[model samples]
Target: MKKPGRFLAPIVIAGITVGFLASAYKFVFSKSESSKQTTSQPQDSSNTSSSSKNSN
Candidate 1:
């Protein structure tokens, strides 16, 4: 019978590769998403305050 190492090594390598890719994708998209939120938040707060001021 073949040693289990032959099959297990490839599976472990593939799992590691997939995990690395997934983390990289998340890191990139999360940064972009956070930046978008940060940019939009200031404008949203300003609009809300301005509208409230106009109502007063």
Candidate 2:
């Protein structure tokens, strides 16, 4: 029987490269989102209190 061609190594390498790039992109966006959430959360809370007090 003929042996299977040895193409697996390059395919595995390409898969690993794509996986890392995808992870990096996901990490960047998630970190940005978390920072954005942290920054905006305080503003909303403070606005709510101000509007409540102003109604008195």
Candidate 3:
């Protein structure tokens, strides 16, 4: 029916939009989190080594 088609179009569009947004969000989130962990780990190790040297 014409009415069903009209309703279906918006639903399809919304589903596609949500899927695209979720994927983009996940991609960005993962990259940032991974980078943060990598960066933080080196800084933490350096700090610990410096502190140990100072104590000695």
**TM-score of model 1 vs. true structure:** 0.60
- Tens-place lDDT per residue, model 3, 20-45, is 99999999999999999999999999
* Clashes by residue pair, model 1: none
TM-score of 2: 0.62
Hey, what RMSD does candidate 2 come out at?
Answer: 2.8
Residue pairs in clash, model 3: none
RMSD after CA superposition, every candidate = 2.7, 2.8, 3.6
User: What lDDT does model 2 reach?
Assistant: 0.93
TM-score of 3: 0.57
TM-score of each: 0.60, 0.62, 0.57
lDDT of 2 at 16: 100
Tens-digit lDDT string for candidate 1 (1-56): 77778879999999999999999999999999999999999999999999999999
Best by TM-score: 2
lDDT of 1 at 15: 97
Q: Give each model's clash number.
A: 0, 0, 0
